[model samples]
Target: MSTAHTALIVPPRLGEPLRVVPVEGPDSLKDLLGGDFESVARGDWHLYLNAEGTTGDLPANLRAAQLMHDCGLDLAGAARGPAVILGRDAKGKDTNIPEHLLRRAEELFGTPQAA
Candidate 1:
């Protein structure tokens, strides 16, 4: 199969910035099925983002997003505003401040909240 992978950096919000990660290899398909990421129905391309990597290079979000677009990856399901759910915070926690954030993420991302 083509090694070309798909990357995504959802629009971030007040909490922190998310890493622009690309999915590939074996787990890539599983991640798409709601394994590693939460499913977002915002648009097309099956929007699913990691719950961690918010403290990543904040400035790179747009650039990475643009790269995804250039790579012919689907982004219609991407968030128009700041991102909501992340794999975890810089410290490796499931959610961030404003406890409701997790709930909102669960609601929108369509995944069960972490324990």
Candidate 2:
């Protein structure tokens, strides 16, 4: 089983500041993605687990795709404006993805964790 750790840095624009939150597995990802989950293909799926902590095994690429699907759904209702940051930490180093759907989450649902 493989595990990965990813962080979604939601920028403040719609109504909140910047927030850095980590997503461990599928369950934790669900909280950030909500419904509308699907399977990831190639670019749509990836992993970044933390070697220091344990969170079961990392979900499959398909699972990551599902999470991305959910993210898309969340973005549909998000306001258009500032860009949100979705960092994929593979070696614990932050790697930014150009086109991120999670940004919509911040625009639609104000940053609850930011507070």
What's model 1's overall lDDT? Answer: 0.37
Displacement of residue 11 (Cα, Å) in model 1 is 8.5
**Per-residue lDDT tens digits of candidate 2, residues 33-109?**
43223322233433222221113232222322233456552223222222223444445333433235445444545
Name the runs in model 2 displaced over 4 angstroms: 1-4, 9-13, 38-115
Clashes of each: 13, 11
Model 2: how far residue 22 lies from native, Å: 1.6
User: Can you write out model 1's per-residue Cα lDDT over 17-87, one digit (the tens) per residue?
Assistant: 33334445436534532234444432223344543334332223342244335435555534233332223
C-alpha lDDT of all candidate models, in order: 0.37, 0.37
Local lDDT at 35 for model 1:
33
